[model samples]
Target: MIFESSHCPEDSRVETQFCQNLVAQANVDRAITPERSTSISPDSIRPKPSQAIQQIILFTPSRASNPQIQAALVKLQNQVAAELRSRGFTVQSVPTGLDSASAIAWINRRATPNTFALSLQTDAFLNPDARGTAAFFRAGDPQRQQQAEELVKRILRNVPTLVDRGARPDTETAFGRLPFVRQLSVPAIVLSVGFSTSPQDRNILLTRSSAIAQGIANGLAPRPVQARSTTQVPIRIRLNGELSENQGFILGGNAYLPIALLNGLAINFQRPKTAQLFT
Candidate 1:
């Protein structure tokens, strides 16, 4: 005989209750089980795994009127793009000679949350002595300011000979706002590698192009975030098996000991001067 409900016969209360419990358990099990499809289809529109991270858009000024400066900027731009790609970044090399508006439009079209844009260009000045590496970010943006600072730092570290012009706001530029730095939704910067007008700086850019590219790659490379523990682990110090008054602390898996605790260790060391510490 067919029952009205899918449960056990209602005539037997015990059997009905047991069936009800079973039904409830089965419903819960079905709810918790993850849904899976037997058939799978590939999505052509999905981006490859490698394209999802560390995407960089590299470009040079299309309005570089000076033939010499334009050539140098393009050469440097290509080198930087190659270097970044070698480091596993997805590099989009925007073609040279696109007008400012066109270039910005092209970049914004492809820019994602993970994308970073850099405009590589050479500075020009009538003084001819204006030479050095400078980076500009939008004014009042601390994040971009830090990024600019790091970029300059890495470039200087790679090529010590190049003078550090330091990171500045776009407001300091001849034109108040840099479209490349301000227009993009993603973080962007204008890197003036060196003054093409300066004889010394021009020579360095031409000769030390590889080192500069490596430096730019290094600066753009993502740094691993170090996890810091809120709980401080105290390390006990012992002098010849006797507990000493001074104690050390464990941080980032390393034990840091006080200088005073090293007195009886028979190790000779000089205290670092104030200037040395800062350096």
Candidate 2:
């Protein structure tokens, strides 16, 4: 998210400390999980776990005209790749200085159905006031749209100061089509972190680099979703004809509202001592 400021701010000690804390937390969350019991019965056999789909291909625009912007993009790309590697992702970064066609070809040669690709670039405009975070996906593709939304959402969560330009189709881009989003065999997204022309945005890109990288890493490789029961399916909830942010679930042909939602509505309910409610 990008916001306007009067001057380009220097990286303060406070910002450095904050970034360190965020990166540390991200590492802990991604690296640690609960351990299963080690003791096993003699007759029991352990099944081999399926291989994880954690491959990622990351790259940045090789032809950025501005030398300063190009250098910053490379730095941000390396920061994101390092963060993802710390989170146990197998990240392959396309070499810098490759032209667009060659970069796309390199990714295509390595991409598979299980691979996810992300191209990072800072936006620029004649109008310096135009500054914000935006992501582009293949036009009319739901999966790409979902991935783009998640990417923007994660970034905003990490840095709320920037305006959310929202997820857009590649057709809406100035170029009308981004090969990185359209030509790759795997799911792909093109992220515009912020407008390099805007001083405020440049300050953010400089000071909040780690947070931005962590946000990108989080979006690209989100935590694994827990298995759901077959009897349960997600359902949207509505209140007074307005959609509620909190979702409920349909279980055994019945719609169940979450306790948190009921509490928000000021509804009073008593729980039995033996009852367990999961939100």
| Poorest lDDT segment (10 consecutive residues) of candidate 2 | 1-10
Cα error, candidate 2, residue 59 (Å)? 1.1
Residue pairs in clash, model 2 = 1-162, 2-162, 2-163
TM-score of decoy 1: 0.60
Model 2 CA deviation exceeding 4 Å by range: 1-53, 224-279
Q: Could you tally the backbone clashes for each prediction?
A: 0, 3
Off by over 4 Å in 1: 1-53, 222-279
Candidates' TM-scores?
0.60, 0.61
Alpha carbon lDDT of each predicted model: 0.70, 0.71
Q: Specify the highest-lDDT model's number.
A: 2
Candidate 1 colliding pairs, count = 0
